[model samples]
Target: MGRNVKSRIESESQKNNLSLIIIILLALQVILSGVVLLRIVNLEKLIGGTEASEPVPVYVEGVSEGDNPALGPEEAPITIIAFSDFQCPYCASANQLIKEIMQEYPNQIRYVHRDFPLKEIHPDAFNAALAARCAGEQGQYWEMHDALFSNQEDLSIEKLNKQAEILNLEMDQFNNCLTTRKYENKILIDLQAGKEYGVNGTPTIFVNGYHVNGADREAIINIIKDVL
Candidate 1:
């Protein structure tokens, strides 16, 4: 009888130990679930914060058209000014969009192109701006402008010269104009004006003095449509 009682006691002890182990496992699972849920919540909050912090569009006062390359009638009802970098891909895209916009709107929109060369990042950009202006002296500004953007991967001095030749510009005059940097002051003025107007990146556009901060196709179209 005593042996049977001892055996029963051992069995009861084993069952108790098994129950404790199961409880511990359940507690660990609960902790892991809580940690995962907390992480998910925090991740959601971070994404929400980021979306909430998107910059609001700026309305700049006195945004100038500048003495720069232009398309469409001078006295067109709408003036669209762009501060662009020739070496910037976004600027190139914006340039194409502007072309389409001009074609669509015809003579109603006056589109002006101003230099805002990001010389630090795009070492060739300042020179490219000069090349365009040099070609402008020969009444082929838009032609050179198109050429530079079309061959954006290569805006080296040699390439600029080749482009001038392709356009049949008097090479001596174009070379002198580019080498002397005749439009340096004008380009600097444009850069300074862009800073004042809160332009921190390339292809910052102004539609009737209202700032559209990027190559935002939809925003640009909407603004122009609304204005018209």
Candidate 2:
């Protein structure tokens, strides 16, 4: 009847409408769970190496470098230092290419993988990295890393442990390393290095001392040519 009452009524109506909409969306989400899962599956296929169109920024690192220097040959003529997330699609694509390069060079090129798991977006990525680190302690880092990338669609802890088991790592040790935050400091250090490398996204790579400017990796090959 009065202005205050009208305002209160409107506010109450608004609250009720918002609540109703939220409930409806929640129902829709429930109904579309299968569709969501299907979409996640489809997106996984397009995850890495799908779009080679985005022009990436040319990166530079004055003091920042790759995370694991010990993973490759000490005398490698070319070093590809990369900061990547376990769950990122492009990271997976870069990894697939790097695998090919490794087989191609055998010993000439060193590929260093750094843990840059983006927790907010990909919660399972950090755990995957940690699990891989655990496997690394057992001389199976590459095994775990490959498994993670190969099965990027399922980066769950259950899946990570399954991968660890396949790598022959002791289950207890793997779980402990993941839950105890064993590689927390190392991950942080790698993130700092990523920052120094001027990385603002996953799959940021540097050849020698310069950043590969594009996601497609043609720029990476060019850098390698000049250095080699």
Candidate 3:
């Protein structure tokens, strides 16, 4: 009877050990599955980014006009319609880069500047854009454009007003335009246009209807040169 009892205890111990091993194996499988799922999600994001970086052709429908602030000749063979956010660092860099490109192909490119401010990220951006538009009313659009970019670090209402003052813009008129949101509708129209053109982010340049996203200076220059 003692020997039989001891053998039964040993069998039960073996069963408990087997159960613990199975539980551990199941937990490991779950952890491995989670890791694989996370890796797949990260890989998908990388693939999406890779696909986005490639340039796509966009059907841009609009005539280059004088109503908006523009540089270079309206009749130039290459038309560059740029959708930009003022407070964006990349946009600021692209602003300067575009200016250089204009200088390089002065007679060949008609550059149209449109406002596409990402107000969610840059709260002061819409106001800064309005400041530029108001300055345009005073015949100093480019002046204010340069000023805002130069002082991107300090784009408070006071700094914008200071920029206006520096540009010699009529304070009363500028203030009224900003206060009343005079160009708000126009800015909205530009944003809608950007959306129509599939502009997911700033510094989206349409070089004769070829869409180039981001601050790709070389790609922009090459596209213009190809058209020229």
TM-score of each: 0.76, 0.70, 0.72
Of candidate 1, the 10-residue stretch with the lowest lDDT total is 51-60
Could you tell which candidate, 1 or 2, scores higher by TM-score? 1
In model 3, how large is the Cα lDDT of residue 132? 91
lDDT by residue (tens digit), candidate 1, 1-228: 999999999999999999999999999999999999999999999999998764545678989887888998988878889899999998988999988988888998898999999999999999999999999999999999988888999999999999999999999999999999998999999999889988889989998888886877677777788888
On TM-score, the stronger of 2 and 3 is 3
**RMSD to the native, candidate 1?**
6.2
* Candidate 2, 1-228: lDDT as tens digits: 699999999999999999999999999998799789989889877775477455653646473443563456879988877788999999988888877776776787877888888989998988888888888888888888888988989988888888887777888987888889898889889988777667789887777767775355667667666767
lDDT, candidates in the order shown: 0.90, 0.79, 0.84
Determine which window of 10 residues in candidate 3 has minimal summed lDDT.
Answer: 57-66
Candidate 3 per-residue lDDT, tens place, 1-228, comes to 999999999999999999999999999999999999999999999999998775655556652332578878868998777788888888888888888888887688887888889989989999999989999999999889888887788899899998888877889999999889899888888888778778878878788877776767777777777776
Give me the overall lDDT of model 3: 0.84
Q: What order do you get sorting by TM-score, best first?
A: 1, 3, 2
Give candidate 1's whole-model lDDT. 0.90
| Clashes, model 3 | 0
